[model samples]
Target: MELTILGTAAAEGWPALFCACDTCKRARAVGGKNLRSRAGVQFGKTHRVDLSPDTWYQEAHLGADMSALEYLFVSHSHDDHWQPHCLAYLRPPFAHANNTPVQVYGNEAVVRTGRAELGAEQTIAVFNEVAPLKPIPAGEMTVTPIVASHKVGEQCLNYLFASEGKNVLCAWDTGLYEDESSWKFVENVRLDCVILECTCGPSKCERYHMDYEHYLAFKERLEKAGSVSSECIFVATHFSHNVGILHDELEQYFSPHGVCVAYDGMKIVL
Candidate 1:
């Protein structure tokens, strides 16, 4: 399994365009690994998560093609997470002729919103409404949507993706797992990596996103439940400018405990 971090920031991103906050200013100073954008990821050029408003930015900067992506999992319709309107890029003949159609999987609401936004375009991407725990195959991987503990004004999800013997728990844009039933799926499945959310400034309180406190708690719970391996790696991402902490700050907090803080364009081969 291969994981790529195209973007790893909260809705506003780590260094907000017009933000003049201390954290944002600090991030600007260290403009490398600390910089982030709306979150998203891809696997081996085929499967993907959400299509953020920054989708084109990711493609341009990361050298990825939207038409080449085969499976897209919409984690819900939050503005930062869902940019169905962006699918216009997937129109007929797409950026190139060799590209295949992108297949999107999500809930009824997500499908409805995607269709409404993209119109009835028949060649961009295909949509499939899926429920939690229902596994679907994508290339050489199998993806299972897990009910997420996020604002459900629209449906949201975190995914459990497994390829070969490697499994990754895709988590972000939400605080602690609020649903116990979903915790069961997390507990029962062992994972090789955990892509978690740590969107916080050094002083920000935890809400709608996880902070260091929740991050630690998640580690403790996973250890107790034996849902991870000794070699299991933890990845923290989804940064917000308000959560002024940067990569080194996060490494200071996470590395000693064997966790990794992700950066835009970073890739991990599992």
Candidate 2:
């Protein structure tokens, strides 16, 4: 399986749209890895996780062939992650030769929001509502949505993707794993790669997102539980300007911990 980090910023993006903070300023000046748009990942060439607002930019600049996308797994209805309106571009008049609908998998809120925004038009995309812990066959991969500890009133999700004998855990946008059900799901799987959200960066941990300290503890727990081995690739992504660390600094801080700070366009094959 191949994983591509399309975008790696948190909700507001690195060097946020309206931010002038020291970290944002530094990121803008430094460019390169620090210059992120939003969080989104593409598995192989067709299956993707989260349709960020930066999807257009990713396709235009990062060479993402979204037109070839077949499966879209939305984490939640967060603005930074779920931007269903972008699918409108795939609809008639705007798009041509896109006959096959992209099968979208998500929870109730995500499905509702997608139908409300993208309408019943099956020309571009279709929604297939999913619940936590249920494994569904998507293309050549088996995807299991796990409940995420982020936001109230809606079920946010992390995903376990198994394809071609390799398993990847997309643990983005979640806080500490306090749910026993979520932990039970993790314990049974051997992860080849784990992508964690370090939205809070070096800051104090929050209820809905993880910081560096929180990530370390979580990784330690996973390792101890035998869910992740030393050979597993640990990646940190979904950064925020509020994290107060630039790309280089993030790499410096996490490298010793065996975590790769994901940058846009980073690719991994396992």
lDDT of each: 0.81, 0.88
- Lowest lDDT 10-residue stretch of candidate 2: 91-100
* Worst 10-residue lDDT window, candidate 1: 91-100
Query: Per-residue lDDT tens digits of candidate 2, residues 66-160?
Result: 77788999999999999988877776578774546888999998888888887667557789999789999987999999999998888899999
How far residue 32's Cα lies from its native spot in candidate 2, in Å, is: 0.5
lDDT tens string, model 1, 194-265?
998887735455456777888888888988999999988899888777765667877897888788888888
Relative to the unseen true structure, what is the C-alpha lDDT of residue 10 in candidate 1, on a scale of 0 to 100?
85
- What TM-score does structure 1 among the candidates reach? 0.93
TM-score of each: 0.93, 0.97
